[model samples]
Target: MEEQLRELGLEFTKEVREDFVNFRADPLAVVYPRSEEDVIKLVNFAREKKIPIVPWGAGTSLTGAVACKGCILVDMRYMSSILEINEVDWYARVQPGVNLGKLNEELSKRGFFFPPDPASFFLCTVGGAVANSSGGMRGVRYGTFREWVLALRVVLSSGEVIRVGEPLRKNRAGYDLVHLFVGSEGTLGIITEVWLRIIPTPRQRLVALVGYVSSLDSVAGIIIDMRRSGILPEIAEYVDDEVIRALNEHLNAGLRKSGGGILLLRVDEPDSERMREILRRWGVEAEVLNDEEWERMYSLRSQSALALKASAESMYVEDIVVPVSRLVEAVRRLRDLERKYNVRMPVIAHIGDGNLHPNILLERSEDADKIFDEVARLAVELGGSVSGEHGIGIQKAKVMGEQITSHSGKRVLEIMNGIKRLIDPESIMNPGKYVELAYEINRSEERRSSS
Candidate 1:
């Protein structure tokens, strides 16, 4: 493989790589492709050699999505470019390697901005966010990357280049294959270019509300009450006391810590009073902030994971989402797990959407895997997804299989596996993860049951 890659005259390097969550990969060679043509050539060579190919974005993935052994890592950094920002068309055409923050900054100058602001927006690539279908603080109102992506140019495992979906919003020409690859986590194809739907920045006067609650249950109650009262905040986020401590200790963020946690809520000016009334009902006083103060809090929320990382040796960030109705139960279950394991699991959540990120401070603990699986299973039991935004990488494959089998059916898992096989017959494109790994785990369980 090395000789063949050298013969092809590609810019390749041998190195050890690691994702944000410490998932490591030792690739045979990491190839930097400068253009779509370069990606096509590399794909062709990998296909011919039957070597597994993994797409490299900004290395911001929390799951072990990009971790592979002996695989060819297609680093897209060299191809980073903002090709076009069509304000009239309300879309942005960009290379996969473009930094999401940079793209948004450019769009902001034109009075338009992409909505999907993942927590890693400042550090992550647009390709990684699209591939993970990432969600963030704005997810409560704007949705995730899956909703914003309009079209994609992908290089298949057979080295065939194909464009899926159109830049237009109302294209029904075929089966939404654009979405299939959106959160596929580099398992299906290598995305070389992306077209994202852009919208004008909200001009409405917005208010940011900060409050500290008594418990996780109080936070869940507030969200449920807001839902029942028909009050939708622009963004609703929570970071527990432990998370606040981490932020203060690591980032020097002097935050008031309550036994419960801190809640950050943003809403339009018209509904600001209503949001405040709701918080008061919860026995919590909310502080309304100006734009400048809100931006500081927003940045702090985005850096919650990083702050936790600085405080811990190793951390397993579990992205489990339960229905809003069952959030209290989920919190109770989480507390039980913490007590059972005798560990402090700090939480950061997009509470409006029930996407709870329970940071299990691993610290090289052997029982971390068991605790992680238990958290994921709790989501499934409560009729929620194992993963809300972060796709199932190598880490959550087994729990994903269990979720599918329990919620949808065994047939659903089989169909997903079928689609993966149909697309990459040789399993060269980021093989042995996501749907492929989920299907394999399901099959293994079946075999055990039969035995």
Candidate 2:
């Protein structure tokens, strides 16, 4: 493989790589493609040789989505570029390797900005964010990457270059193939270029509030009340006492340790009083923050995962989301799990959306996998998803299958697998994970039942 790639004049290196969560991959070679032509050539070579290919982004995937063995890793760093920013069209066309934060910085100078600010915005690539369909603090107001992506240029497994969707927002041509590839996790094809919808930054005066709550249930209650009262905050997040301690110890966050946790809320200046009144009704004291303080707090919340990672020997980040109505029940069940396992699972949450990330802090015990699956199952039982934004890489594949089968029915899994087969018939594009794995699990269960 090395000799062939060298003969083709492709830039590649042999290396053992690992993702943010330590999911390792030992590829035959990591290739750097500087253009779409290079990607097409590499795909053609891989297809001829029957070699599996995986697209490499910023490697900040918490779900092990980029992990592969004995494959060609397409490193997209050299292709990074902001090709076009059309203010009149309200869109930006960018290469797959463009740093999300850098792109936003450039967009800000033009008086426009992309809205999907994932927690890893500073570290992740636009391609990876689009691939994962990532959501962040602003998701409560702006939605996820899926909502912002307008079009995509993809290189299929057969070396066919195709562009899906258009740069326009209101295009009603054909099926939504753009969305199909948005969060496909590299299973369908490799994205070469992306068109993202951009909008002018809001000019409203916003107020940031921090509420020290008594418990996880209290956080849920506050969010529920705000929702019921028609108070929509731009950002509503929570971090428990253990997470606060971790932040203080590891990141020097200088946060007060409340009895239960802290709730961070941001609202328009006019609605700030209403938001404060809700906190007071819950018997929680609130602190108003200045612009600088709010930015620091937001950065700290984004780095919460890093802080916890430093404090733990091994951490399994569980991205489970329940409905707002079931938020309290989910919290109680999560507490029950912690008590049963006798482990301290510090939680940080996008509370407004019911996306709870319970960081299981423990050594690599035999029960860790069991606890992980149990947490996913709790979300399933509560009529929620196994993953709210994080893609189902190898780690959450089984539970994802369960969630889909139980909620959307087995036929949905079959259809997803069928789509995978249709796009990459040879199963060479990031094979053996996601939809394929889920389908295989379902089929195995069917075999057992028949026997």
Candidate 3:
């Protein structure tokens, strides 16, 4: 297999060891295909050999999505390219390996932008974003990658190049395979290219940092009321007081100097008049800032990992998501975990979408593994998902069982395995991620005995 990969003029390097959420996995081979043809050749070769191939972007995934144990790791970063941008349709065709930040910069020149801005947008690749079906601050309004992706050119495990969806605005298609592959992690197939839906740049923008003297429930109530009144914000976020303080101490920047608990808000529209009225109706007492301040606030919200790393001895973020109505309870339960576990649980949330990144900062004395375990369990108990944005990488694989019911969980596993079998039946693509063939059997047997 390695010889065939090299023969195809693809770069095949020795094994590259990696870890996601502490789930360690090492690949037998790492292949970098410089072009789509290279990808096809490698896929066909792997299929013939019955070897699994895992498609990887920038490897910024917090979930076990990218971690592979003893399989072919196909790094898609080399495939980065902005193939074409259609000004007429306000869409762009890009190779999956293109960086989100880089792509946006190119789009900016043409007066368009992709709305899905994950925290790691600068580092994450578009293909990886699609694989995880990632979402971010703007997700409350724009939703996730699912909404932004218009068309896809994918190479199934069978070495068949299939085009799923199209650049059209609407379609009454049979089955939406585009969406299925979006969040399928790496279990489905390798994504070669993507046609992304782009939006016109907002003409007006406003940001507000609101301080609440009351509990999280009060802040949540404000959001509920705002939603009921039909005020859809472009971006709405929450940062616990503890998290704000940690950021201040970490960056030595006085961000914590302001609010009691903080709600960072950003609104955009072609008309600022409507925005101002909406803000007023929400009864939010916030200090409105211009574009400059708005950019600074966005920097603070998305660049949280830098602050977290600087402030804590060690840290891992818990990206838990629940329904909008369940967000308040989820936050309260997280606070309880903070006290019970004796760890620094600084909470920040995309409140509009009810997704929380409850970052756990740990010291040398604290058991990081135990703390993560408890947090994962809590995510399930609250009617929330184990991961909001980050896919189930190695970090959350163990707790994955808890997220789904036994019957439903087993069914998902079976479908994933079946799809894998149909694609790269040789089991060579992204070996251990999402659905691992070897582990599938073991887990199914375990489920039977437990029942």
For candidate 1, lDDT tens digit of each residue in 241-290?
99999999999999988899999999988888888999999999999888
Range of the 10 consecutive residues with the lowest summed lDDT in candidate 1: 1-10
| Alpha-carbon runs more than 4 Å astray in model 2 | none
Going through the candidates in order, what is the number of backbone clashes in each?
0, 0, 16
Q: What TM-score does candidate 2 reach?
A: 0.99
Winner on lDDT (1 vs 3): 1
lDDT of 3 by residue, 88-157 (tens): 9878999999999999999999889889999888888999999999998889988899998888988877
| Per-residue error (Å), model 3, residue 301 | 1.0
Candidate with better TM-score, 2 vs 3: 2
* Of 1 and 3, the candidate ranking higher by TM-score: 1
